[model samples]
Target: MTANAADKSLQAEVNALPWFHQIDFGNGVLSPGWIKKSKVERVSRTLFDPLNVTGKTVLDIGCWDGAYSVEATRRGARRVLATDHFAWSEQCWGDRRSFELTRQHLAPSIEVMDIDVPNLSTTTVGTHDIVLFLGVFYHLRHPFETLERVAAMATECLVLETHLMRLPFTTEPHMRFYPNDELHNDHTNWWSPNRACVEAMLRDVGFKRITMKHPDYRRRRGIFHAWR
Candidate 1:
């Protein structure tokens, strides 16, 4: 088939949708996503090394626009499952159109689901060699329960990224709760835990090995690698 009117129509459809991740859709076209920072820039290269997952099953929780999902496939993961609920719900500025379109263009074999974190289990989503739980932890109302649930499905490793709080004088397990839209003017932003607290939670949930990948004190963000 030749590139014609149908192709242009499809490209137009993709451009019209609201995107969160900067997804490139070939032929010099790019989805003008809202997020300023690139996923690769935030996650970084060294972080991707320990979570190599070559020929291993990979799961990307809260996979908005399937950026990491496509990255996992690029790393030669045997199977990549991208799961999302909030962003894909088609409300607010989020919709599954970007993810669906991105997957169609890149990493066509990637599987996607609209499952929440609490419902994740061996029976529901099966087990994965590696799970990417990036930028979703603080949003959970039941942090412990959700972390435990995610831990159960990971056979090898879980790479996590979330907001952190630095007390400056104390190294205690503390988490600031936002009952309203106090955090970044968004109501979905619920909890912000300190670095020690995050590590403790991972240990409590049955991770044998825990490593802090990136701890940005200036930005107040943390990246942790937990091994099952």
Candidate 2:
């Protein structure tokens, strides 16, 4: 087959996957998954899709279900490491069963590791071409410090996604909800951060070439693409 024909075939196969159908975004409607619908995926496809990843390394931090890791491997990453704190009991939409299901589905191309975030070290995870921090930062108490550690393990790029508070707001703008407080303790809950605070934190950690983009659909959240 010609290269165009091969490309079309691959695209068709990817589109036919179950994940390409729709995501169960919690409330219903079965919207398309972020990879199929969000700006982050579009941006990633534009920048990195052409690169050959047959022997490259990728690390996915807070890889809740290994979805991104699976995609990385499918795109030709030789090895993809998916790590998470595995404290799903503390998730805002807490569901341990769904996490396991995701793990099972991504078993072939991804390696899942359960580790404590603060204690992450080179001994635990070595360096990689890309390190993804999708939707993990706001959940941490020391977001900047954690990014520093993650940077040490990333040789090229770090892709991050998190909730950002609007500008002209103080830390006070961030509120604490006690909805799941009784179950997981106060520390294991959610945090909403302001964009300025997040940018300042990243700059202080020595991230360069920072590019921020709001998701096409979920304008409330943002994606930060940076290099060390």
Candidate 3:
């Protein structure tokens, strides 16, 4: 079978799973099956669509359920590492089962690690050709520092997806910060960041090429790609 045909078959299998049809993002109740399938589809399209992934090493930070890791492996990544804080709560299993299932489904190519994000070092999870940091910045207290650390681990590309603050030209309400709190919590639904601030931060972290994507000009939300 052709490579494209194989990929389509894999994608179809993932989408056909029952969990993919039921995910409650508003309530933060993600079906691990759905999250894994959707992330595989999105990351595969975004990162692997233009470039060849064979023999490349990919790192997925804050990988909730090995979704991106699975897709990277399927796309020919030689090695893929999935890391997350795995901070479990009463409501969530912290994606433990999903990671294990993904590992069982795809062997050798993907490795799952439960580690604290702030303590990430070269000794723990080595550098990679591509790094994915998705839906994590808003929750971090030191977001710029986090980006710097993630950049240090990426040899080629970094894909970041987060909530952005509306700029002055945009017709969106300013987000209010909690007293003495630089981080967003369950109480705070969103912590929007201005484009200028994010650009400056990325520059400071040694990212040369940067591209931003948003649903609209209103700057309600966005994703960014930074290359070293």
Candidate 4:
């Protein structure tokens, strides 16, 4: 096949599925994803720039389209596992095709699991040196409990990226509950916790050192690194 024909075929396959993360598949073809490329690149830098995943094991929870998982492998992680359930099931509008295609064209060596947040544990998933919990905390109904589970599987560091709420006027940790599609008109969103709340929760979960930084896109959305 000619190069142009290969590019067209790749583009057609990518267009067949819905995507959440914009992934560049080389050959001048990029997936038509809802998340912008700039935003994803910015977030990726924030998530991956500071840390060295060389020869490390990584677990990316809620890896909707295998964006971070593939990147982790590219960044030198020896073993990277991309796991999700809702995103790959009929429970929601999305399925695993986009991720499957992306991983097929990008990094096939990376591992995958059809696991959900509640099922994640040290026993079920085993301990990884780095665990990525990006854009998933707020969507979960049980943030604290889920964090505990994620912490258990993260033997060295856990990088969490989530929607944040600013609860002004008090130093005490607080979280804003969204009973419905109150945030961004997405019903899947459940809670947005403040920075203080997140830090406190990390401490409670056994992280010794914690640091939080705001991303460039949103006003309060933060990416936190908790070290065990």
Candidate 5:
């Protein structure tokens, strides 16, 4: 087949799926994903540094489209594991095609698992130096318990990003429950915890040092880097 034909075929396959992460395929052919958020620019530089993953084992929970999984591997991580079940399964607006394609096209050596958050443990997925728990906290039914499970497998650090429920003058940790799609018209979204709530919860879950930063306050998206 000609190069143009191969590109057309790849484009047809990419356009057919629901994509959450924008992945770059070579020859200037990029996946036409819905999310324009540059995980490399916005996420890698500010919230958490990908350069820090050099020679470390990394795990990315809810690794939609394997963006960070590929990034971690590119930054020289010893081993990279990506996991997801809800978005990859038939219950959501996404599938594993994007991740699989991205992995195949970019970082083929990274491992993947179709596992849920509650099932994460040292024994199940083994421990890692860095664990990324981004965009999955609010969607979970058991938030605190889920963090504890995530922490159990972290040997060095855990970086988490989630929707923050900002309540001014509230020093104590608190969470707002979303019943019947009160937040975004998505039934999967269950809770939005304030920044204080997330930091406190991370400390409670055995992370000795916790740092919180907000990429966009108006968007209510906060990032946390917790160290063991």
Candidate 6:
């Protein structure tokens, strides 16, 4: 991995694809991505600082570009499995090349699967000590049913990051539905659940305890740490 290769061959490959997570290849080569390098680094801290993953197995669902998956390996996780489908498929704007390219440079030992949200099961993917369900909740058509499946795959904890719906006047469990691309400009964006709704869903899915925080100053995003 020389500077010349990073500047020429690797950089060209990175430039050819769409990237979700901005990543540093540690050789002065960086992926020009939608999620900037600084933001991803900040989110990484917000995600990992509250807990430890050293020597633990982690499963990352919707692991586009493998940012968190690679970070788990960097934090000394015993094993990591990064999975995705829409973000890697032809239907989406991105491709699997970004994730593969990042893993080739950053964390080669990490496993990967082209698994969709509905197909996740302990029998298929095996349960993990820590499961990362980041930025995938609202995109699903069946958030509650999917939570049950996701919960079944977490042996200890589930870290869920999602776009939140603010119903400031009420504490009731409620989710707002986006019939079109009204939430974001993307059609994949479907539902946004408020704090109470998400917490309640986590409880119904078998988590003994749940905590949520908004890393950003904006009230529309949240990260839920659920312990089983």
Among these predictions, the greatest TM-score belongs to 4
Candidate 6: segments with Cα more than 4 A from true spot: none
* Local accuracy of candidate 4 as per-residue lDDT tens digits, 48-121: 88789999999999999998888898899999989999988988877798898988989998888998888888
Given candidate 6, what's the lDDT at residue 223?
90
lDDT of 6 at 93: 86
| RMSD (CA, angstroms), candidate 2 | 8.2
For model 3, what is the error of residue 228's alpha carbon versus the real structure, in angstroms, after optimal superposition? 1.5
What's the true lDDT of residue 67 in model 2?
55
State the weakest 10-residue window (summed lDDT) of model 2: 20-29
**Candidate 1 positional error at 74, Å:** 0.3
Candidate 6 residue-wise lDDT, 1-228, digit = tens:
776865788878888989888898766678888888888888888888877899999999999999999989999999999999988888888899899988888899999999888888998899999999999999999989899999999999999999998788999999999999898787889999999999999999999999988867767899999998
Stretches of model 4 off by over 4 angstroms after superposition: none
- Listing every candidate in turn, what is its Cα RMSD in Å to the true structure after a full C-alpha superposition? 2.4, 8.2, 7.6, 1.0, 1.7, 1.3
User: Model 2, range 1-228, lDDT digits (tens) per residue?
Assistant: 996676555445434433422332222223233344354356456435534557789888876545566668768888888887644435433333444544454446677677768877667988888878877776677766787888778777777777665545364334233345542365554565655556666667777767777755556677777776
- Candidate achieving higher TM-score, 4 or 5: 4
What is the full ranking by TM-score, best candidate first? 4, 6, 5, 1, 3, 2
lDDT measured at residue 134 in model 1 versus the true structure, 0 to 100: 87
TM-score: which is higher, 3 or 6?
Answer: 6
Identify the runs in model 2 with alpha carbons over 4 angstroms from their true place: 1-54, 87-107, 168-190
lDDT of 1: 0.83
Query: Would you give me the overall lDDT of model 5?
Result: 0.85
Per-residue lDDT, model 2, residue 78, is 84
Query: What is residue 61's positional error in candidate 2, in angstroms?
Result: 1.1
The sequence of per-residue lDDT tens digits that candidate 3 reaches over residues 1-228 is 996676566455444433322222222333435445454455447555654678989888877656567767878888888887633223343545545544665555588787877888667899998888877776676676777888899888787777776457854334434444444446323354666666667777889988876533435556677777
Residue-pair clashes per candidate: 0, 1, 2, 0, 0, 0
Question: By TM-score, how accurate is candidate 1?
Answer: 0.90
Better of 1 and 4 by lDDT: 4
